[model samples]
Target chain A: MSGTSMTTRAWLLLLPLLAVMVAVIGWPLADTVGLSFTDAKLVGTAGNFVGIDNYVKTISGSNFQRSLITTAEFAIISVFAEMVLGVLAALLLNQQFYGRTVLRGLMILPWALPTVVNATLWRLIYNPEYGALNAALTQIGLLDAYRSWLGEPGTALASLIVADCWKNFPLVALIALAALQAVPRDITAASLVDGAGPFSRFRFVILPYLAGPLMVALVLRTIEAFKVFDIIWVMTRGGPANSTRTLSILVYQEAFSFQRAGSGASLALIVTLLVAVLAAAYAALVRKTAGSNA
Target chain B: MSALEIENIRKTYGAIETLKGIDISLDSGEFLVLLGSSGCGKSTLLNIIAGLAEASGGDVRIGGRSVLGVHPKDRDIAMVFQSYALYPNLSVRRNIGFGLEMRGVPTAEREKAVLETAKLLQIENLLDRKPGQLSGGQRQRVAIGRALVRKPQVFLFDEPLSNLDAKLRMEMRTELKRLHQMLGTTIVYVTHDQIEAMTLATRIAVMRNGRIEQLGTPEEVYDHPATLYVAGFVGSPPMNVLDGVATGEGLRLDGSDRLIALPVHFKNAVPSGKRVKIGIRPEALRLVEDDDRQPALKVAVEVVELTGPELVVTGRVGGQRVTACLPPRTKLAVGTTQAFAFDDDALHLFDAETELAFGR
Candidate 1:
């Protein structure tokens, strides 16, 4: 068969999926970009053309700027925390033990729980009066008092990060565990015989093997964390003075709470653009790694 | 004290015993090969010696010091794995130096060691390249270089050349033999390839079903296999064993009335009317002319394979199939009836009941 005909056949096979993508994803995204260039509001019946106004305001606005910084900080800190904790969990779970299978199954529970449910559960745990965390702190005499965890501005963002990491770290752990399994037991044994201690074995052998998978996990979690809204919304709703207002929550506030439809569309579009950039970078990195390994 | 001593070593995975009691004591600079088929516990034995796996029973000592509870790193051994197991991210130089760095060798010293070993392996030009950039043979040299830089008390090899192609494996085998001669280090090698074990080992320990079948010099094992299993397992094309009966005149082929004369070594030991199995190496059987047939058997040739310097011919005598190795120029074809004789002096007679070699 000719190359053109083969290409045509491949396109024909992909037609149905392409139609679904166009209808589900392409249409909404195009509509959001179009809507962003107009003066549309939730209360209005018609929109007036106002080019670049939404984008300009979204960039210049302090709330949007702060939300962007907060999102970046949240993503970096939480992903780093998850990577460290996930690797530790993977190492512990990789060993042979009597109840290891049971423990591994239990580790997936936190990741499997719905994000909304996890957010609500953590919110309850961080309750001011009758929270488990405060009670434990008081019992252990570590806190000097049962201070409000989620209610206080100083602790809320950090608390949310802890909750996000707890709910999300198992995903990282699963990836790291798969990578760790691929690492030959013999290399680790070789390292041990070469007088490498536990830390050295991890640093020299295990870390190099984990590098590719860890980068993938980092990118994926960063994208997810940048767009995080449901968990934060359920927990603090961008609480006291907008401390925990990430890009996703800021978009929601602009479009729904403040009823600035065009501006909200613009903010959402920017967040989409950021996520796309990360996804592209990750794909390029993975391709390079695969090529070298090949 | 020996350089390495393993006494009553055993390994069990839950209830399934993978390695039965194994005892080995080796002087410094000697090379030992654990020869076995897959699942015969050769790799497990290597791991146990490296302290990668704990022995369920008995003790392991390296350099005259007990290492029963020591970690693999503290055991003072360096290992080369079958898969090479090179760190994909690191350059060959870094990989070679990684061991030294882990052992707290100074950076300059580690660099010097890596360069010296690289030059020795002729991988100095490939030092800047990662394992992914190299060929199978290069990666193998780097793996060996990595182990060499450690300068450990003992070197462990777990079928290191098994991953290479047949041609490369042969070359690496020769290179490894040369390397051992140069290093003069105590080495414990594991391989399922009997040929590799035969060529490389100063002493071969043949294992079967988690137990050592026989331990001897390669020549001794080849010349005097201890058991029927060993006889069948070792040697290329394998030693052919046939069942027969000792009659009044000579040993009679089973189901045939012909009595074959016994060689001088077995003449005194042969008893009348006793059943026995006789083993003969393929090389010991020879084709003869019809007039020269003294104790010859007539058979139809089944297959004739010309392998460069020799012709491996398979033929049927009575009901049993027999093989003979002849000169390369020997003209024999399938379906041709040919007369062949077994060298009586080279014949191995075994007691059928106990599967032990009977004659002197």
Candidate 2:
């Protein structure tokens, strides 16, 4: 076929996918950017376009600043906890043992469950009056009486963090486990003959293999934690004085409940920019590590 | 004291025994090669000595100290693997220095040692690069460098040069011999390649079915193999065997009705009327025209292989395929009948029952 004909054929083949992408992503993204500058409200008439006003108001508000910090804190703590636990689990599971295959299969359950289902599950488990956690703690004498886990500002955010970590840490484990299998067995044996102890061997030898995949996992988990909504919405609805509210939850409230589409759109764009930066860092890490591993 | 000693080493995996009672001792600075084919347990023996694998029953000693319970790292030995196994992420410098750094060697001292080793191996130009960036030969040298930096009591090489191409394998074989001479370290090398065994070993332990068939100098093993298996395994184109029966006078061929006499009396051998296998080296046979000799046998030529500098010919005598190494210029054609004579004293008689050489 001629070059023009070939180009036309290629474009035609891509039409369905391109159309879906435009309808779902491109239109909404462009409309969000355009609507952020207008004074759109839930009940009032549409006001005239006010450039930079929504952004300035949102940036100056104490609520927005608090939510930003909350998102940062949640991402930092939860991603770190997941990374450590996931790597430990992966290392333990990588070795040969009885029931290893069964254990590995079961380990994916937390990650395999849908996000909304996981949130509902945790909500039932954390119910103050009848939850298993409180009953078990009381039976073990660690608690003299049952107390609400998500009803207090001090413990509510931490409870949410624990729930998020339990639900998502397996992602890191899967990536890390695959990378561990590709580590050269001879190199590990060589390290043993080279006089390295177990901890030192893990630090110097095995860690390099896991670093790239771990970074990718970290970027994904961080972005997810930053825009976290479902678990809080289902379990606590960002309650207890807005202590567990994150950027996405705040955006949802501003857009739908309080009827400020412009402020919500501005905040959503900021969140997207932050996630993009994290993704770029992940790409760089993959490049730097991929070059050395080969 | 011997540099290394292995006593009654045995390895059994489930119902199968891979190594059955191996014993070897090496004097300090001796280069010993364990020669065998795959599944012959040469590599397993090396790993047992290196403390990388545990033996079912054995005692291993290096420099007069037992190392059975000691970890591989504390056993005072270094190994060069067949796969090179250089850490893919570390630079060449770090790869060489890692062992020392792990043992708490200061950074400056480790750097100095690494540089000295790189200089000795002529890999100084590639110090900053990772192993993935190096060629096969370069990686082989780096693997050797990783072992050399330790200067341990013994060096265990598990077919270290097998991964290289033929030309590089030959070059590295020579370089290994030179390194052994210069360093004067106790070395145990394993390889299935007989040529590598013949060229590099101070003493060879030829193994078959997890047991050493013979242990001797290269010349001894090459000139006189101990068992029928060794005889068939050591030489390329292999030593030829023909059936024979002892006679009143000497020995009579089973077929072709040829008679040959021995220079010595059968003093210790079972007296006449015994069946035996007669073994002869290919180089011991020579083509002769008719009426040239009394002990020559006539045969139909089957195949001719003219390798440079020498020629190998195969002939059928009494339904047995016998190979002879002749001069490259020797003229012979397939399907032609020719007379070939063995050297007067080159005949080896093996007892059919034991498959060992007959008593002299």
Clashes of each: 1, 0
In the order shown, the candidates' Cα RMSDs to the true structure are: 2.3, 3.0
Interface RMSD of each: 1.4, 1.0
lDDT of 2 by residue, A30-87 (tens): 9999888888875677756999888898889998899999889889999999999999
In the range A38-90, model 1's lDDT, one tens digit per residue, is 88997966588899999998899998899998898889899999999999999
Model 2, residue A242: C-alpha shift (Å): 1.3
Cα error, residue B234 of model 2, in Å, equals: 1.5
- Scored by TM-score, the top model is 1
The CA lDDT of each predicted structure is 0.87, 0.87
Q: What 10-residue stretch in candidate 1 chain B is worst by lDDT? A: B290-299
